[model samples]
Target: MRRETDRTMDFLDEYRLRPDPADPRLSVAVTGVNEAGEPVETRVTVERALTLFLNSREIVTMMTIGDHPEYLALGYLLNQNMLRPETPVTGIDYDDDLGVVVVRTEAETDFEEKLRKRTQTSGCAQGTIFGDLMDVIENARLPATPLRTSWLYALTHKINQTPSLYLESGAIHGCVLAREDRPLVYMEDVGRHNAVDKIAGYMQHHAIDPADKIFYTTGRLTSEMVIKTVRMGIPVLVSRSGFTAWGVELARKAGLTLIGRARGKRFVALAGAGRLIFDQDLAYVPDEGARHRRKGARAAEDAE
Candidate 1:
């Protein structure tokens, strides 16, 4: 996440939920030379820094594209263990001019000690840790939800087709919360962690039950991403990107169904293989269409 430090309010006012090349707010025009040495001016993704403060103390700063700052802040603190699971978040106030957000809780809390045990995670651009939450994944009892091949194919197609910063600027990642093949919420940010955090925050704020929703991301399946999804209590995690070895091991250990390299007509389920229903036959089903193949796509049978 590239934090510009000051583009929060101004850029957000012009940012649209649907991806648009014309939205100058999400991107900026820059002049550069192309591979052929020709002059080119194109839009690049915008980055901004947002500081999070829990109660009266400053927590941490996050680099983002400026959309959904409030949700990102809440999700960051919650996942960091700075905020208690049952703690009542009284209010979240964002100050655009200052590029800061303050989260108010019902209880007067302090995590001065926990804040020191930070672990730098491989969450892409943004990285931080406030406590030892590495083992929480093993404690989650995910619901035994079945994911059909039909649902998987449809979900990938729709997600790839949806307008997003990834299509608009290339240097972006997105995360979606969905039920079956239907997408319930779509979010994009400079870093994969930011996108995932935004989704988690939205779920927490809205009180959306994660018992049945599937978590999807355009980012790679890493240990950090897996842990966050599991912490949200989501059973199924899908990614269009490849998987990290540690990510796979952790998912298998936690019993979380992790699917990766998911594209048209093909997907590899590494964890929670029991939930998959092979309703679609490979003999009849067509390969992933070129148009819908997103970034980080791999050969269909390469791993699964």
Candidate 2:
């Protein structure tokens, strides 16, 4: 049998982008007290402000973990409808000292009107949507992709076991872009929206097709999450967390398959149930072990 460490290495080898939890710049060590009042040291995620600029016009400033600035800038603009998908990008300049990223396009673009309208979303670290959320996805036609139960089990197990910032620190949100049972890219941030935007930016940069991909998150399946998934053109969205009412309603309208509370062998499909294929037998599927449980899972258990 292959060693667990080797298995992890092989899984990580397939990722085009994954978290670097060991990076000193991403986190810092601090002394704290445990439940019993014993002094303990732990690493905490570091947040940096990144101001995005679309040409000479300044856009929103977001709090992030300070990785993948270019992707974040591009993704944020793309999702906000400020940057069109077909827009030619002449350059992306990121200044580390000033903490700013500028995305230059072939044509002059202005979103002063869109910037005036913003809606605060429920995502962690304060997420904002610049325009009508339904305008972009109103005519979205998601492909009828079949998601197998076997692949779902494989993905959840592998993702939970993968070493990440959430496992390293106590707080963070992760978003993964996966194909079948193999996870392709994993991005984490202070806000779930930032993580999703990072994946979007990566896809935009690589010209990757999202039709065959599955989107996974460690955050709640909220309306923002659903909108972003539909905007990315991914048919299925899954999470190890629960769902929201608007999230479920929007998923059904968009024909996007939404699955949540997906830990171990159990899951609840709130929308697009027609796309699920029950290929895996429950008898063979083991329960999610404690060792592989994420921070969200542990918090749920503690509440129960």
Candidate 3:
């Protein structure tokens, strides 16, 4: 049962430069006022879905910016835990005429097991994940990376400054994979989780290390989102929106840093404050530390 949305807005397809260099350039009118308060127009790309198949079986489809179809397919499967580093992927084929990606996998996976593992997600973009529909806070590792205020600022500003299809069409969500203070990859989709999956697929295909990277999303931090980060073994998950209670609890158990409301200079650490290394104890007071030290000394004296 293959089902997909029909609301594909192909700004890129509708606006393409002609091969004839001698011809005058073409332009289209876009809605919006510019800095001079005049109606402005900018060239943008189209977004659409490309179906994915594994060994002739329909696995899933992705809604993306149509710029990187192969990468998106590969990334999506990896994030969904459908494929691991050792999984033997024989080949991948993309049919532009039909807009479908056929992936050849050698792993003899049970069809029913694969189907049962899928869960329809609430991500702004269409997302499917493995295991239980909702997360249970167990088996998530504790976070060991220290979060810095400066890193958060850079991450938020970098996300805002990244090139986006949404800025032109206002209809997409973006996901970025960052390492330390720098963003390594950015992907946008009609669905937020799909964007992250695309990135994950790319990482898996390229065998990129994700141990120290931070995953950022334009959508809310749901429990499934936390699980995705956990699957990648990444310790940090930052979002521009709020986190669900399940997400917070999972992060606490997983030892992952859950940063939410990542806008401007005001961001909330929803869980795992141990990862946050403050230069000046913003949450801890030196007086409290001294008081504790004094109490310990008094206890020792009383014992003596």
Candidate 4:
């Protein structure tokens, strides 16, 4: 018992976070006020309730923009500890009109007890973490990857310039699965967790390796976000937002490389700093451009 306890204690000390805006593909028309308080007609993010059914039993409803419902459903089940990694998923059925998704697994499954074990998470849109969920943290092996400042700079610039739902519509969060400085998969939703789950689901479905990847977000580095990133076996997390006390603590325990407040050429990493290679010169790194910057984003005026 002492040896097991010590291992768990060591795990507890290890830890991190890991975008995006209104995508026209996911936005709707609405009237809103501008910075000057002038009435303007434009598009706004569209969010709706999506009910998920695992095989025959109803699971839970989520509020999302519905980009990848299949991925969201599978990912949610995986993260909630309801679906084991080796479980064979037969098929995922989604009915967009009814806003319902059903994930058919090869093996018999039930979630009544799992649902009862859920605890509220800090994620927006009512995220839930199940009992024993954290146990998966022990087996999630993140690769010892190196993060360079040059790659960080290039990533931030490209993401800013990409025309997204956030640029057109305002109230949405983006998550990206990136390699080097290029984004491989970009997902957005009403809640940041949902966005992350979609990416997780996609990665799982396609058997994408997390070893050489980085996770990026436009939201805060909260504990929920950090836990998901760690469970996904992602070693590095970058956020344009700041971190929470518990969030930082968790990352440190999990040995996650946490980078937050990543805007333009500026950022701060609290844990796993050894993974960061500061290979870029500040003078050569360009500040974020105006049009690409999010509304109310930290300006480069000081660097101006």
Give the C-alpha lDDT of model 3: 0.65
Question: In terms of TM-score, which candidate is strongest?
Answer: 2
Candidate achieving higher TM-score, 1 or 4: 1
lDDT, candidate 4, equals 0.79
Q: Estimate each model's TM-score.
A: 0.87, 0.92, 0.73, 0.86
lDDT tens digits, residue span 237-258, model 3:
8986778998788777777889
What would the per-residue lDDT of candidate 1 be over residues 56-85, giving only the tens digit for each residue?
898878888887888898888777777766
Native RMSD of candidate 2 (Å): 5.0
What is every candidate's alpha-carbon RMSD to the true fold? 6.7, 5.0, 14.0, 8.6
Q: Candidate 3: deviation at residue 256, Å?
A: 1.4
Could you say which candidate leads in lDDT? 2
The number of clashing residue pairs in each candidate reads 3, 0, 10, 19
lDDT of each: 0.79, 0.86, 0.65, 0.79
Model 3 clash pairs are 11-46, 12-45, 12-46, 75-201, 125-191, 125-192, 141-254, 142-255, 143-255, 147-275
Pairwise TM-score winner, candidates 1 and 3: 1
Q: What count of clashes does model 3 give? A: 10
lDDT (Cα, tens digit) per residue for candidate 2, span 66-141: 8999999999888877877778899999999999999998775647777888888887877777877787668789
